[model samples]
Target: MLNASNPSADTGITPARRTTMLAVLMMIYTVNFVDRTILATLGQAIKLDLLITDAQLGLLQGLAFAAFYTTLGIPLARLSERVNRVSLIAICLAVWSGMTALCGAAQNFVQLFLCRIGVGIGEAGCSPPAHSLISDMYAPRKRATALAIYSFGIPLGTMVGAVSGGWLVEHFNWRVALVVVGLPGIALALVFRLLAREPVRGAMDAAATTVATEAPPSIRETIAHLFGNRAFLHITIGATLVGFVGYGTGTFAYAYFIRMFHMGYAELGLVYGLVGGLSAGLGTLLGGWMSDWAGKRRRSWYALLPAIGLLIAAPTYIVAFTRGEWITAMWWMLLPGLFHYAYIGPTLGVMHNLALPRMRATATALFFVVVNLVGLGIGPYATGALIDYAANRRFSASGLGDFATQCPGGVAAPGAADSLQSACTGAMAQGTQDGIVIMLLVFLWAALHYLIAARHMGWLKREAVASPAPARQPG
Candidate 1:
């Protein structure tokens, strides 16, 4: 059995042990995502059962979850620095797993909303500690690849959520699907608690002949340290912008595909959930590998490649959105899918490299907090709101408003057409087009942050006050 408490003082772990830890972390990550994403895939079922609106779905998916998830990450990350990380992660997994099951049982909007907040709070405890732990387990040279491998949870979870949740919903119901998916996380938590062990802080420091035995930085100090790193600031903001579009697209793409392409639930599961997700996973790994290879030659390659990738992705995504044919759209989707993921690994790598070992988790938590609040919290809502706004315009033009003067839902415009459905569809189509174009432009703005990060990469490396010194080999 593995030690669940502290690591050995000789933090120079064997290769096999390091590999085992990475595997455990990846598994934990997979469970983390599975719980998070199932809700997004089953949105229609949830909406139908609860009689909720799109705006409410946005809150469920974004703000409610993000509110606590973002705020709690810093405190949890700080705690990990001072305590046993593996134990912290195990405890969080249990809490979130229970909350996930609770979501399935919610009978009303408030209950479901509160459950989502609980899920977020639990998830907030996961990444920062895992990041800090992996930083010590692998040398700086290997950290990006390790982290990328761990990050595979995002796509893997998405695939499972899409495919499994879709099939379950078709056969049974959303409540049952949530229960099935949520229950597995509890077993995973026990497994982690039994098998995982905490690693020594700053264990990868190879250059320093003498170890620094000082305590970890306080919360304010950790934050101040991150704020001082210019490249991290630019890259974090850039990543947030990318997330705004990336996450926004993920939440709405199914609805859009169903509307635009008439894709069945199973079809949505196969194409976007399976094909699209697998591609993103591959892209994430490849991006990390490329960063490792290219970063060795020029550090700016960390941010440069992603900027270039996003620039290429922008035009292709526009084409993907404009297509009337579903097959044509999916094909175009493949190209941008490859380009879209090129940033995640490198961006995360840059973040870890810029922070002290003790502060890596805190830095990442802060990064996640801002990124999720601005990006995940707002992205879906922005799209839904835009669509709603466009709906108003469509109704106004069709004179439906006049027709339903006393109706709370309002009416279609006068010249819109004979049938309300056709008028609504036309308006929605136009609005959807405008909304997507606006979201795509967000990528262009995000790309600039990557470019700015590219220029400042060297400065970030120099700003590291307590980064692990290059590791030493045995004589």
Candidate 2:
């Protein structure tokens, strides 16, 4: 549907304008993640205050938001290409920002869940357009670096979210914290609308010389084209697997610390927040830089970079799990966090390179669907369910079998083992620790996917030429 070779009507763009726009886009990205991460940081407090289960928390953090985010991203991205990207992004930001603040006002589980869904819907506009925009802003050679700078939002935003959410939640209630963290994005929405201009679409195409194509490929066609791409398929699957592990780790790490080592919110905010954030940020940037540098020689390194990083990361995370000392664990976790997130920027660049200009946003959205559905939607939920199962197992182990027994409706009906149930409940904290260990194994499994992808990287890149669209310039 999208002919990469097709050109739009713009002359070459100045580097200065590109740089300025990218900075603004990056700032907006930072806000996007900051708002998103804040909820994760305050998860425990929210759980306690709202009297919900970890499974429910997982739902809120994972599927409830990701469902809309992953689903709507593609259509919206398609819309961005057809309309003004800046306007689309601005409106989405405002909606999501308002939704974030609404989260603060939620008095019950249902309300909060609804608000999270709104947040997801709003955030759906982000990556597709941003990826598309960045592609317009930079040439392929420099795209990874620009993307890495944009991806820096993950770490920095995580840091800000963690520290800010932790501090606010620790001092006040989760609601107030939500209000404080969410409101800034609303202001950013206005700033973005006023200051940011959509760059000429497809302006950076290296080969095509035409003015423009009037319509984007149909959604079905975009999918068919992208899915037909072996590299896109492999990387999409690979990235999804990695996301499963990465997001799972992020969701549970703080809670695991609390259960195993008895760390509180403040400590988590301070130690994991600051340390993990810095490490992740550094990793994100480093990974991008390395991919761009290495990719120049071996185009396959775009995929290889993540493969190598994940391989190294798996063992370090294993060690991190066993560490009893908080300081020791924190130190070990820093680099691991950085390396774990390094896959983001390069992976995005790869997606941009592989897709035709018209479908860039839609391509990104499609990737988001896979990545978020598998990774964000299921990761935390699976881990939480595992934790819940572990809790049940712990209860049974303590001779609370009858008390923990499930009835016809999957409800836990009090049985003859109430005494044992009480005993196991007394040790619920330990059960949670064991569950976290089990969850860590998912990451190990995810790492293997990256290796598999690396082996096929050469074939993937070569396949991009199969449907090579004529290169185009910005309109």
Candidate 3:
């Protein structure tokens, strides 16, 4: 067994090897988000081509992908505890990539939706095992920074998806864009399989007594233990609400630009991609580094940092969304993510730190189940539904006939009267603007939960330090 005090003494992980593995994992995660986010980046084109409503688009973005993704995460995470995580990650990467490629071939709404479900199913195996692997490699003190580096994949992948997806859709059709982004991951999977090696389970835990030689707790036990803790419960709730707002806004951000500003697909993608990547990436790194730095002194900093970030992000987002010009709006966009994404590193870090090494993957899977179900599952759908409601109301108030009958896909029928077209255009823009602003408000509520979690974190920390050894529980 490796010494807990000096993990590097026995583990064969040289600095070079460790860096390589983290980079490989980060790239794999990047591809994961690329596949997941391409649909959203290409959403406007997909909506126009399929003649679908915002709600249908939301179903495709949120529930279709999240349904199986959230469902299969736990079982796959459980399997990770007993199997080779590197192999599992490689397999999942290939499956999701293949499924993403198939999406290009989908001819209609139903077909595309099914293809998205496949993508979700494959992606379900990704982060939990990866998180387990990461915790094994980094000690508790460094876990947040390491995980934040890993989490950097979120913005990086989104950037690649938005930038590449936009340019491809502008040059070719949306089908070609999807295919182009999807096919590359197969080769990446092969590369990851060859390059990545699984770290010994629990190698970095502070106490050997809590390491993976002990049998992992049963699913029931794990769930009960996680939810029984007030800190974890509140963190989970706060993260869920944040996810809800993030997904809801992300799903329609491109649409908002196109409808309100008439921005071209390529320009919009490039601008949004840069803004998101730079700002969110900086925010993620800052969150991790700051939390780890501040947390060394006070554990509650982990929760407090996220709360403060969210409070700042909410109002800044509102300012950005309310801007008249796209350029002006995007300028405001850069500020919120810097504060908004600070939660991710600290949250994941805290979750892993709170659990025994054996329970890390399950904890992550469970965390995702709640976060994805309500956040990814309902957020976009709710926003889209609200958009539809608001647009219809605004259109009707203009003395126009039913909005749905007069405007299909938020555009007036071809050769329709100028006044009708104007009403449709203005209503669509206003509705999208309203929906995004409403979603931003949820960030305030999410911030409050983090504050509550902060109050409980000190107690949780004492409990953890008091019990260094694992207690036997019946299976």
**Best lDDT goes to which candidate?**
3
Which TM-score value belongs to model 2?
0.88
The count of backbone overlaps in candidate 1 is 11
Q: What are the runs in model 1 whose C-alpha is more than 4 Å off?
A: 1-13, 207-212, 402-418, 458-475
Name the runs in model 3 displaced over 4 angstroms.
Answer: 1-9, 207-212, 458-475
lDDT of 2 by residue, 49-106 (tens): 6766667878888888899999889779888878888889988988888898889999
Better of 2 and 3 by TM-score: 3
| Candidate rank order under lDDT | 3, 1, 2
For candidate 1, lDDT tens digit of each residue in 1-475? 0011222335655667778888888888888888877777887677657766556777888888888999999999888878888899989998998898888899988999999999999999999999998887866766778888999887888888888888888788888888888888888888887877776677675432232465777778866666566666677788899888877767767666765665777768777787777777888888888887777767777777788889988888889888988888888877787778888888887677667776788888988988999887888778767655665676578776532231122223356445875665556556556676678888988889888876766523533221222222357
TM-score of each: 0.88, 0.88, 0.95
Give candidate 3's total backbone clashes.
0
Global fold similarity of model 1 (TM-score): 0.88
Each model's C-alpha lDDT?
0.75, 0.74, 0.88
- Model 1 residue 276 CA deviation (Å) reads 1.4
Ranking by TM-score: 3, 1, 2
User: Which 10 residues in a row give candidate 3 its minimum summed lDDT?
Assistant: 463-472
Residues 196-217 of candidate 3: C-alpha lDDT, one tens digit per residue: 8877777676555456477888
